[model samples]
Target: MDITIEHLARARLITTEDREIPVSATLRYTTCDPLAVYVDFPAEAALDGEEVTWTFARSLLDQGLRAPAGHGDVQIWPCGRTRTVVEFHSPYGLALLQFQASALRRFLVCTYGVVGSGQEDMAAVVERGLSALFGGV
Candidate 1:
């Protein structure tokens, strides 16, 4: 239920007029090693439907393995990584957990590729992941 992080990562975010539109991105971070990053599409809107919620979670875990880093605003070779789950109560508005290719595959196989939760938990996951990946102020 509680996730704490104390590492500095490279990241940037921007909001557009479209609320429902999913934000695509590629991110990389160092966790013990130069961890390759992958994530699902951005999970926008409050997750109310079970199917939709799971969809976003699965996407994130699924893509965690592959490296999706880039040098521009838009991804060059876009890959569906992981959807961000936000935890406002903790700190950051949301957290985007980047799954490495091996980690993604391993998690999917080990966990049966299930991701997501109610808005509250989703937010918690997001916040925790963000804090871990990026430095929290």
Candidate 2:
């Protein structure tokens, strides 16, 4: 059966003027999307007044905990000793949020509990994809 790890983490949104706006974000990991991690933001935090979710490589999150990782629209890096910063870019603008490093580490550990690194059953994932593409033939 597929398993999921869901976490709610408090974040500080970094504004251009150097102000911090407290926001709540949802972190999600699931066997169904084994290669990716998802972070969801509420409508209040969006420029278009709608909830937004960004998906990026799961490895990026793990690497970012040690150093900077990712490129393009999403980037993650360590912030000081107790925090992490994840930045998202879009046509509207950029959202930079700081999260507790401990919280992120806990979440990452939980994900590993469900699916160990390099242990993903890619054949199953591809089978599902082909099933969807061909309607299980």
- Tell me the tens digit of each residue's lDDT in model 2 across 1-137: 88888999999999999999999999999998798899999999888889999999889999999999989998999999999999999888898999999999999999988998998889988988899999884
The regions of model 1 sitting more than 4 angstroms off are 1-56, 63-92, 113-137
Q: For candidate 2, what is the TM-score?
A: 0.92
lDDT of 1 at 63: 42
Evaluated against the true structure, the overall lDDT of model 1 is: 0.31
lDDT of 1 by residue, 1-137 (tens): 22221222222232333233333332222221111222323344323322111122333433423433332222222235533222111132332332223333443443331222222344554676688889873
TM-score of each: 0.21, 0.92
What Cα-based lDDT does every candidate model obtain? 0.31, 0.92
Top TM-score hit: 2
Candidate 2: global Cα-lDDT? 0.92
> Least accurate stretch of 10 residues (summed lDDT) in model 2?
128-137
